[model samples]
Target: MKKNGGIRFLRWLILFAKRFLKDDMPASSAQLTYYLTLALFPFLVFLINLLSYTKLSTWSLTEDLLTVLPAGTMQIITSVIRETIEAKSTTLLSFSALFALFSTSRAMNALNRALNKAYRVQGTRPIWKNAMLSFLFTMGLIVLIVATLSLMVFGQLIGEHLFTLLGASVYFLHIWNLMRYFLPVAIMVLIFSLFYRFMPNTEVRFSNVWRGAVFSTIGWIVASLLFSYYVNRFGSYTRVYGSLGGIIVFLVWLYLSSFILLVGGEINAVLLYGDSKIK
Candidate 1:
């Protein structure tokens, strides 16, 4: 019993460290999706701006309706963009034109693997189909952002109303303290629904998706906060590197985001695997 216990402890520790560093597993198909996500984020943002009622700047509908990240975050992002554009916007734009075709292939394969969670192994898709599905995924991404922003607005309104009724000061104390927790929970719920509804491969139980969603979400929030802290502290990489530093920041954020997502997938698979065996 003690021997088994030791092994379990070691395993848990290893997993925690991986959560901290978000190291990539080379063979993972999802890793390609990570790149695809990075390569595609800007394009998707462009599409969302054209189609949706939002711009990437202030009063962004996407943040209010879909992505609901905190205020002032966009300003940091804009600073990054401006710096990048000043340096090599044209080169990056040309590179994006070339990468759009190949990098998305990695993403399509990764999404297929995820759909596999819903059912049994299936045949591969044609290139056109992957593009179509990827496009659909892109649409879903916009809706998701809009929903988040909307919820954030609604939540803030409610929190404000409650504070007024309950002697604003004390209520304000609690609301301010819990913003991080509530905002992330809202996002987790949104992601859980997105996966449950859209994934095309198999029929995953709503429960499994949410469990994975929550796991992924918590990991994402903590990791991001830590990254911000590290960036502020030892690295101060953003300030020293100036606009160039944003690339480093972006790479770290993207890689870590991918790792958190995969960890959630791993946890979901473990739970599903156990359930299958028991049945």
Candidate 2:
């Protein structure tokens, strides 16, 4: 039974690889990277505007991004945030909101098409319907991002307060500190799973999506860590590209992320269909 299981698994892996290549996922990822790049700054401006009305407005959101973003990318993001704050205005906010919606919807449409291709489904949804769904997904994604960031930023403080109120041991914080990192990962898995299950125009069981979600999450985390290390140690983008280095690095990172996300959907399609033909 063990030998048979291993053989079957190897066969599945081979099939998945073959189909992944046939799907031309790299090209799709490139398209996604373009739309994502266009949406990114607009989305950030919209989020900042929304957060300005909340306590989190004072929080340095870029600080958290520094963990994974390259120095050049971080510099660009910091500069953008500073400029946005310095030039805050209702007119700018409204314009950003509209631009964000339009750009994010385009990004979501790209994602939708990619996932549809991954699942080997025809995108039969009308343009308006797709636009509406993309808008909804964008809003949901923005909320999820804010929530995740809030949890990461305030989770420890909240935990400490609760511990103090409950008269818990100080050692509990060490455990909380460890668990905090894992918690965001869990949320990320949930987010990805939800997207995998729904973003595609097909019915997918939660069970079918969970494996892909976990794979994508771990793959993304590992890739980001490795890339960050590479950037910090050997990359001299600033010397090479001058002020534009940051944008270049950021686009490369987005491309990697987009590829991983689409590949996750491909993984789900493979597992769900098993050894069946993928066209």
In candidate 2, the residue pairs with backbone N, CA or C atoms under 3 Å apart (3 or more residues apart, or in different chains) clash, namely none
TM-score of 2: 0.90
| Tens-digit lDDT string for candidate 2 (1-279) | 999999999998899889889888999999989987888888777667666766664446547746787777778777877777777677878888888788888888888888888788888888888878888878777776766676678778878997899898988888888887787788789888888987888888999999989988999888888887888899998899988888888888888998999889899999988656575
RMSD (Å) of each candidate, 1 decimal: 7.7, 2.3
Kindly list the per-residue Cα lDDT of model 1 for residues 1-279, writing each as its tens digit.
Answer: 999999987775565444323323333434654655565555543433333333334334333332222223334555544444344445555555456544554565575565453233464556677667666664555455555555555556666667777766775857654783476467666664565434545456777667767876777777877776666556765467766675666556666766566556555544555434221
The local distance difference test score of each candidate is 0.54, 0.82
Regions of candidate 1 where Cα sits further than 4 Å from its true position: 1-30, 33-76, 80-109, 114-136, 153-184, 193-200, 236-243, 274-279
